[model samples]
Target: MASVLDAGPFFHGTVAALQAGDLLTAGYRSNYRPDIVMNHIYFTALVDGAGLAAELAAELVKGVAEPHVYEVEPTGPFENDPNVTDKKFPGNPTRSYRSVAPLRVVREIADWTRLTPEALQMWRERLSALSANPDARIIN
Candidate 1:
């Protein structure tokens, strides 16, 4: 089992509407790689970092779905998310982590910064290009 190494007011981002005490598990498909089913639930200590993830999750709906950030607690041990912690970076600078166990939602967060329309569009373009390229892979 992975050890929990950091203290956090952890958060998870997604388009799903969840209530407090709800559990988030793995096995979801990502817009970045719809062909793959993720094995771990991801979270970050940084609220805005989770905001970014929420935005990306909502981006798939092209303004139809609402992005949401939720304060969460891991139900079990977790480890640094290798998707961002390594590969090119040296440490867990993003405060990102992942686990096979469920994450319990504490509450909704409303104050995280939202990307401007232009910025969101720019990200959409980047993602489009990334999707076209076979090498732009999700580390999971």
Candidate 2:
């Protein structure tokens, strides 16, 4: 199975917040409408196949498989103010504004493909393979 080490820095923050039992809140700039600001406490991550399976198993055993997983593709670069100093806010010049492609939440793993066409084919294929792998343990 894969490990959490493979996830992005954002995933690391999410995992840390979950472990510390803290509310994860952040504001995100809108891509389509740059003037719009949105606040969110929930975020998703594209996890390594093996890592996800392992995490799902552990969480299910604990009765909390949370911070749901989803497949995402960034349509554009993450916009941020390059001049910022403080890494956390308005003081910090740079802020993660937004990405061109918005992330879609899928209830069933198979629904990942419905969000996009050929773009998500690779993720679907990988997930399908992982699901078929007998060695990958799924708690529920």
Taking the candidates one at a time, how many backbone clashes does each contain? Answer: 0, 1
What is the TM-score of each predicted model, taking all chains together?
A: 0.90, 0.22
What is the RMSD of candidate 1? 1.8
Error of 2 at 104 (Å): 5.5
lDDT of 2 by residue, 1-140 (tens): 42322133232111121322223233543221223344432223434431333333333334443323333323223433222224334553222223333333222232221223353456446556755776643211
Tens-digit lDDT track for model 1 on 1-140? 54557899999999999999999999998755667789899999999989988998997776688999999999988888887787657888899999999999999999999999998889888878978999878877
Q: Which ten residues in a row are the worst by lDDT in model 1? A: 29-38
Off by over 4 Å in 1: 1-3
- Badly placed stretches (over 4 Å) of model 2 are 1-66, 80-86, 89-97, 104-140
Candidate 2, which ten residues in sequence have the lowest lDDT sum?
A: 11-20
| Model 1 residue 2 distance off true place after TM-score fit, in angstroms | 7.4
**Candidate 2: lDDT of 32?**
18
